[model samples]
Target: MFPTFPHRKWYEQRIDTMEELEQHVLNAHFPEDAYFRGMPSADFICISSFYRQYLQDNKDSLNWSEQQVGIGVTMSLPEVGKQQYKESSFEILDYFYKCLRELGSKELSFNSIAYLAQHYGLPTNLIDFSADPKISLFFACFDEKEWFTDKDCTLYVSDILWHVKAMMPSNQTIPMGYFKHPTENRGMTEAEADEMMFNMFTTIDKDSSETVTPKIELDEVKYSARIHNQKGVFVYHCDDVPFDRIMHTSNCNDGFNKVFVINKELKPKILEKLNNEYKINEKFVYPDVEEDPNLDLILAAAEKTKQKFDLP
Candidate 1:
């Protein structure tokens, strides 16, 4: 569905040093804000950091790449294959919200349920981004051990609401795309209605005329206290999108955005600057970083260790 053909070279810029990386990523200014304000898109522009510049469409899902090799699940299935990907997502969301409602948040909507799932680490295709460049870089530099090579990381800038929808799938050939759900006087196509049916979840962007409230724009939703603090938003992804695909294919004029391969050695320096200068340590990123969530994480690890050794 990336039908836009600008006929140009791939939009990737490699930053060889931390000094330059910082200026472009952390310190750069948007000269194009006036243009951005006029677009029909929601300002879903955000950054994501990956340890490796080449990792694309690396999503957490029912079938993550780590488990795919042995399972023989390929992305090449027919329409049913498409439906399976879409349906499983809906099923997991429904199950999670059902359990929550039983526990008493009676008014959860589908969008809220998806947000909860992603933040709590349940498998879904949503990827995280932040309006703040530093927040995105923090993730890139997180867990020094997970930081590979000379401390190299990549920063991605994307307008997810634009690219993901324009590139959304219409059939098995494409396999990954968004379903058009109308909120106005217009009637739902049978397929669109199905997408909204039982799960009732939608990231609906309404037209100016629609009387029904638009589905929540994920970019605007404060899904949780932790995400709210991190300045995070979820970029909905379909199974077939490679992490790198957005770089070369998005049709928007301003979409070339920025690309950088940060110096590996700079990881520690940046991490230190962030935690000490901006106070972006465990407490900020993890929310009460030293409290319940982190302790729970440590406890879970301890239980796993004890189980492995058959310790009493």
Candidate 2:
């Protein structure tokens, strides 16, 4: 099974200025040399967004989200029973793969499949994150005033080096058996991996197979340039415990879980600093736009793409 989580919430730091945040990020423990001594690639920051920290995505935690998706019956509704939710989650995944196969996606991994679904606005267990620190900052300041009742936003910066080392104590490269990595280490074909995942994903207890984390092989066919532009990575949920839970398995103190508090009053200034000084924005983060930086806004305001976007 996968390693357990380190649920020990450490003392969080609140920085008043972007300068302080930059100094914290700029001074992080990144190995200076790489090519000379065969040093591992330097650790980079990864970020997860929340309108409010209390409303986190706890284990496909869409069930725990307080936000509304604007659909009639609250598409945000959770399942009635835990068992029913698990069963339905697996079934929905199977349905998604079937649709992908029908649409000519051959031998796709779970991460790739889920990323595609997320981009198209489907309700899956997947949550999105970015590797770019500035991009993370962009998300931190993005419209919390409107969507979250004028609430302050949060940005969680995890050091990837600490995270991977914690997850794979022996080998930092060990894959979490999503769809790409199976437990048996048998050289199974993609279809075989699919079947194996179906069994593992549907399991109810602490079975060994339940820990698999099927991700893209070599991550080359990782399915999205929009994702690539952000230097994105993901963690998919399986029957076994997730990587977050395992971080607290011991008194293991790692640097990957740093939390930052961004005040709502500073948002306007922060946005200006990021957009004008750092040159980061919706276009930089989402890179799929033709030319307009405000294409998302344009589309939403237009009659043609507005309804399709489910805009009110």
Candidate of highest TM-score: 1
**Which tens-of-lDDT digit does each residue in 1-312 have in candidate 2?**
112112324524566776776676434542321000000111111111111111232435434322232222122223224454356445544565565555455676555655555444444444454555666666667663465425555565543233223343133245455433543466665456655545453332323232333243445333455566555544343322233333233224544455555556666777787889877776775665553333343222232222433322
Provide the lowest-lDDT 10-residue window in model 2.
33-42
Where does model 2 exceed 4 Å of error? Answer: 1-9, 26-83, 159-222, 238-255, 289-312
Model 1 per-residue lDDT at 136: 70
Q: List, residue by residue over 70-164, the lDDT tens digit for candidate 1.
A: 12322221121444545655555566655555554446555556555556555555566566767777776665355254445656665544432
What C-alpha lDDT do the candidate models reach, one value each? Answer: 0.45, 0.43
Cα lDDT of candidate 2 equals 0.43
- lDDT of residue 305 for candidate 2: 23
